[model samples]
Target: MTTALSPVDPDSYRALMAAHPGGVAVVTTDDGLGTPYGFACTAWCGVSLDPPLLLVCASTTGSTLPVLAGRGWFAVNLLHGAGRRAADAFAHRDAGRFSAVPWRPSPATGLPLLPEDAHTAAECRVHRLDPVGDHTVIIGEIVRTTTTRGADQPPLLYGMRRYATWPVP
Candidate 1:
């Protein structure tokens, strides 16, 4: 049984989520065709380690969701501080996402990994996809991982509707 509310207040929900900081990442993949697809995602985390699993949340209605589902593979590119530009570019609904950004396909999963803007990249195979509300939870089993940051640049953090870096103390 499910309770149906009369009206859903999205503003308050948005405000609540916005109050918490989240690390940014770009999820990229390609269709069996030559076309590539990607998007900026903030809802991500690792769920297990023995089998090496992680999860990323994306809108079920996003154009790239089908590509990810069909291919059963994707790359999670952890964006560094310098990747805000790339994040914004991918956030928009358009083609040519990789036109200006430098990227390469992951060796393990053949998913697109942005080396130019990402601090690290993880190639994963889809373990399962669970649809929750308006979003799909992509549970992945990490097959390959690499870091290009050289332990210097920290990943971008999004909070209060802005991009930032972790504070140095």
Candidate 2:
């Protein structure tokens, strides 16, 4: 039977999502100038395999969103367990996020890459952008990827308002 449903409260929705763990990454890009921008993200996932598409969500009001749209390129730096500081720094809305973490440019896209913090990084060209509610979902076609760490390294994770790491075997 079909039943009427009420709109979910934002707080409740957030709390519910907090229970679902997700791997963390730092999404970085530049404004085509020397300046850079980035943010910690857990709302990203691989969307396709045939064409190598990755999806990342960003807040519409964030400072980096405009630059990303303008440049049409970005890099996803998948953080490892030792990347706690980088994750924390980018998660906040501040002007010093880059200063708090060491980074270099991705060779293919000229986007920022967290060389010290991320185990794997992918440079992507924007494929499409979909604005959903308060966030925009960016679909990108990965052009190049670099792996800096070995498989033994655990990935950083977040859930329940806390940071965690994958258990190494």
Top-scoring candidate (lDDT): 2
lDDT of 1 by residue, 31-78 (tens): 956467999989999999889999999998899888999988888999
Against the true structure, what is each candidate's TM-score? 0.91, 0.96
Stretches of model 1 off by over 4 angstroms after superposition: 1-8
lDDT of every model, 2 decimals:
0.87, 0.92
- What's the C-alpha lDDT at position 2 in model 2? 88
Stretches of candidate 2 off by over 4 Å are none
As a whole number from 0 to 100, the lDDT of residue 80 in candidate 2 is 93
